[model samples]
Target chain A: MIDLRELYQEVILDHNRQPRNFRVPEHPQRQAEGYNPLCGDKITVYVHVDQGQIRDVSFKGAGCAISQASASLMTEAVLGKSLAEARSLFEGFHHLLTDEGSGPSTGGDLGKLEVFSGVREYPMRVKCATLAWHTLKSALEDESATVSTESPNPTPSGGP
Target chain B: MVKTEATLVAPSLDPGLLRPDFPALDQKIHGHPLVYLDNAATTQKPTAVLRALDRYYRRDCSNVHRGVHTLSQRSTASYESARGIVQRFLGSSSDREIVFVRGATEGINLVARSFLGPRLEPGDEVLVTAMEHHANIVPWQLVCKAAGARLRVLPMDDRGELRLEELGKVLTERTRLLAAVHVSNALGTVNPVEELVAAARQRGVPVLLDGAQAVPHKAVNVEALGCDFYVFSGHKAFGPTGIGVLWGRREHLETMEPYQGGGDMIVTVGFEGSTFREPPARFEAGTPNIAGAIGLGAALEYLEELGLPQIEAYEAELLSYATQRIGSLPGIRLIGTARRKAGVLSFVVEGVHPHDVGTILDQRGVAVRVGHHCAQPVMAHFGVPATVRASFAFYNTRFEVDALEQGLREVKEIFGP
Candidate 1:
């Protein structure tokens, strides 16, 4: 029996109810739109990068609790990290949610984002958990690129 | 505070007589009995339809319209007889008007390419309603693009019904064809298609009704509807997939060129040119889905035996029962509440995404279609990205509707305060 606990933890639910950084940053340096066509979950990630270090990041969108909470938690995790560190964190977070055979990298730096480790249980929702991260990746690489989960590989240049 | 199943099981619409005919209904999902409310997508096939498919492949499996062999003759007879069944089912004057296609999507594409494409000139408009499924919308758009014509959309009111008064504003002398859905798949709003057809006819504009969602729920007579073309998927009507009927006026079928050129469509092929078969055969290129057509014929037969009037009456009860049951739930806002609607309950729960609702409902073994439902314009009209659609079939019961209510409560509990 697949546990709903693995999909919707209290921490994730809390973030969903009261998401932080859930606004489009005013005077943002970079912004990109992420669209999940399957469930019509649309998230736009805005980042302010200063001297190769991530200064501030925010997102605004309508989506499922998992996606909204993931974005909320993601913005907090990548706020103070450098661009390179942010990219590594994205990779680690993505691996934790998608890489089923390999154990989750939730112990180290993911911290509050580790609440999403349970997302791996539902394969269909992996896209929801990663939608905000993809938009953030696109924002870091090209501010204008629209990231869609429909496109298997959207703009190869979308990573640090 | 949802009532338990024992308490909730009051006297209401039950599948009863027709439930046993469909084997798929008697199954378990996740650990609970499956309550399939996603009939808008596709219906569970009946035993008769399944048996027809098996009987065709086991006994009379051969390429249709050719060969002196016994099996070939039997296959050809069965295929042609299925066409006759479709003709009688639609109340079409002639069997020649019915052309077999992949599904409604392919049927619309065929008409758009063959009938409408050649006739359309630059600045000519194909008037479509806002509530059309992508099948009805995209094909016309493609034809319009190809023929240098504009695709004009007829607006819908807030209640999800088409603004009939606005139809005259859009229907001009330049309007070549009017394609609209008989029933909105996403909203369940039954369009006043007969009136719409009459209005279009007054302007000398031909009409095509996307009966994909209508045919299964209600009795659709193309002759009475007075539409130039009527298309529907077999799967949606309890038949097999990969088979659909496109019934067109005899005049249009004769005048329009074939959509595709292949072996069966053509009568004779020379180095210079090839002469095609008349009407139905002209459009049905290559070997058709022989088994699928036969199965569809059986499905039509099954529905006929059950009686459309009885099914319609029972389903109306189910729809109203579902509407009230689902609507009464806290934080659950019903999307489509048109004056006239079929058995579809589209809604959004407060503070819960439709996908989350779908997941929670799925865990409770109740199936429903969520998201834009291939009617993004309808979604745009409602100003919601998506909605959870619980569409009903005649086989659906009041008990199933109650189960949907209880499931929604579970969703509310998970996401509520």
Candidate 2:
């Protein structure tokens, strides 16, 4: 049996309780909306990119603990990083949550975002942990478009 | 409280005795005994239903109503007998009225496409309740859209009760048909469908009662309800998935065009055109789910043996007990508190998302539905994105409800301030 504590870690709970950057960034250059029609989870990601570097990142949404916390951690992790670096981080984060063989220690340089490593145990929640990341990725790629977890043709970057 | 004839003279139903009949119910998940409370989604099939499926597949495996072979004859008999069972179960006048479809969704689609779609005009309108499941709403929307007709909604109150007063205003001359959920799946509100059907009749409009959620909980007599059409899924009523019944008035069924065209639904095929079969066979285009229909017959027989009146009374008592037990908990707000409800209890925990609650409860082996329940409009009406719904069945017990309460307490503790 999987331990509940593994999935709902203390850091994840703390982030869910007091989500940082849980707001729309002022004068955002790129914005995108993400929705999981299955669970009614919605998240909007905003990024202000200046000279290929993420000047600011923030989000606002209503979702489960994993989704809200993931978004909160994402905003903090991606800030001040270049667009490519943020994309790499998203890739690593996605790998940690979905790849069954990969664990927190094996996932290279996930930093505090490693808290979502336990999400691999709950297959249903991987989408929850990835909703904001997908939205952020869409915001970076396209100017603005609504991204659903249930998108028929997922982006070439892959989707949950 | 809305009292039905079945609930008035009720016998006791012992869940303890009935529980063992369902093999799926007697199991453990994550070290705790599985407490399945997601009956509104689908029910666990009983041993009788399982045996019926096994027997049919093992002995009489043949296509229905096609060949002159002995096995085909036997399969056809069983399949048609299943329709007779459904006809008797719904108290419809003739077995000809029961047309088998994929499920309630397909059943509604048939009515929308075949019956109402051809008759609709540019200004015609179709009325649906706000609490309807997407199956009941989307089909009408499609038909109305194709015909350039308006789809009107009969609003429900915050308590999840239908505003019957609005029926007169919504049931205008332009209204071609009224499709409403006999019971709201999300809210558990047992709508006054009798009144709504009567009002639609007075307006000279046809009515289709979506009994997907209603048939599982209580006794439903379509003739008594006086509706033009009634539809329900077999899976939700402890039968097999992929099979359901569309019980329409013979007059309506005879006049409507076939929803699909295939071998079994035809009388004779020519190079120019093909004449269709009558009523149920005409609507059931392809080879139907013969085994599913047979299993559904066994399920209905099982329900009949137990008596729906007894099950209804037993479930009502259980619901009240659950309502009191779960409602008394702190920080738990019940989303749907309609005076007349079935076995559904939709609630939200303070400071905790329904998904989190569902996860926590699942850890403790309490299975529930945690989402919009395919009723987004109902959720929107309640101003909630999603809700944790614990729905009951005849085989569920107070012990299971207690387990739910304990699981919820754990959720509160883990997410508590």
Candidate 3:
């Protein structure tokens, strides 16, 4: 009983069509690459964090609607927040997209980002919705290493 | 030739009649009748194969060749009979040549380790095509890396056809093996394997054909094809998973070292030294997938009853219909357009990602694969990240192709034309 409208909302599609922060920063303090080898969806997240406060966040890659929109939405959510706030938002967004109990918690402080709450219904697209966030985490933690969602159990048929 | 040509104009068997045999095909998905076009990934099983699996589990569920009990004997007989069936299906010289593996991946791995592992030396070469699946490529790369051999790839044109002229230039004295795909899983390019085999043979190089995508769609006579080794997964051919066949020439199988070591593969066990059995048993060092083998036997029987010629011809018609239907779209660009293609249609819309295409199609109850298709080199060749793949089987119909076309139209609307 998954709702396609919920998954592909107008806002989500708008973000996918023309993503925000879809560029790599000229001079970024931290950056890391994330790869979903399943669908060849790769993203490089670059952040210009100044003294623990996030200054700029952007990404460059190719992926599906969910992944591209998620990346766009993620940049907007974390741009002015502090590193701590960004990390917290990452957790909140991850929870929202993966909580299989009652589906993604839409009514929360997740803000406009709650539009992606329907992604929880499609387990295959969870990876797509979280690709940018994982890269952002990797960029914050270790800029040298690239992040990958190629877990022991890969997505069936390499869903993006 | 006349039979094949005649079938192109008229399908031999009514696909609707065969459709009922596959119980899974009679279901609904996303509130619509499921249109399974992802047979390249795996095919739905027929009732006969399912019944065989059920019968084996209910009546004869015992370890093979280990016990003197009646159940053991029955199970052993059934398992051995399955091997014979596979041997006949592939037109191999003997049942002893058929070795049951976990799947095509394992079968290729077995050959890479058992046959090519020992013979490869420094400066030696293993020639392959640009269109090979990862199953064929990775194992050879691992073996060549360990053995200090280099892998040479034959190029393909924009139409996804392999450049056979380059074969002569690449086939030098150091070339030890020629492993190729009988049918390209990603591009649907059916390689001229007999010609390739003959070329390899002239230079005294043994060849292995990864027939995973070919065996299910066409009549594969290994004897007529003149390949030294051939492998295919059972699940792709409407049989069960965890079961595949690795058929090799008697000379190669007899001389190769055992790929694995365990109880069943051995003739005598000792702390000092243990002797092994002949070709098939020596290679199949496992409590093999007994039920899977029996199910595969049943699947082969189903195919035999339908007749391979009829199935091939029927699928060819479906392939043509699908290709024409999908290729005629406004913004669609087909990735693979080889003249001799099997049941695969890989393509991309102008600005839409294949994943999006797949999602929209899935919403309409049309199943397809969208990814690098484990053929990243092919993706790189096409200069695209991925393409949506709709692979057909004997059970697919023209109606499903229409569904796919309509699904693509919806995708165009979603992304905006």
Estimate every model's Cα lDDT from 0 to 1: 0.88, 0.91, 0.89
lDDT string, candidate 2, B1-417, tens digits: 434566668768899999989999988899999999999999999999999999899999999988999999999999999999999999999999999998999999999999999999999999999898999989999989999999999998889998988887888999999999988889899989999988999989999999998898888999999999999999999999999999999999999999998879999999999999999899988889999999999999999999988888888888988999999999999998999999799999998999999988998999999999999998898888999999999999999999999999998888875
After superposing candidate 1, which stretches have Cα over 4 Å from the reference? A106-108, A152-160, B1-14
Ten-residue stretch with the least lDDT total in model 1 chain A: A151-160
Two-chain DockQ for each candidate model: 0.41, 0.54, 0.53
Candidate 2 lDDT at B260 equals 91
Model 1 agreement with the true structure over B1-417: per-residue lDDT tens digits: 212232233333347777998999999888888999999989999999999999999999999987899999999999999999999999999999999998999999999999999999999999999999988988999989988899999999888889999987999999999999998999999899999999999999999999999889778799999999999999999999999999999999999898999988998999999999999899998999999999999999888877666667777777878888888878888898888888688999989899888878888899998888988888998989999999999898888888899999888777765
Question: Stretches of candidate 2 above 4 Å error?
Answer: A153-160, B1-8
Once fitted onto the true fold, the runs of candidate 3 whose alpha carbons sit more than 4 angstroms away are A101-108, A151-160, B1-11
Task: Score chain B of each candidate by TM-score.
Answer: 0.96, 0.98, 0.98
Cα lDDT of model 3 by residue, B135-195, tens digit:
8899999999999999999899999998989988888899999999999999988889989
**What is the alpha-carbon lDDT of model 1 when measured against the actual structure?**
0.88
Best by TM-score: 2
lDDT tens digits, residue span A6-85, model 3:
78899998999999999977777789999888878899999887888888989999998889999999999999899989
Question: What DockQ does model 3 achieve?
Answer: 0.53
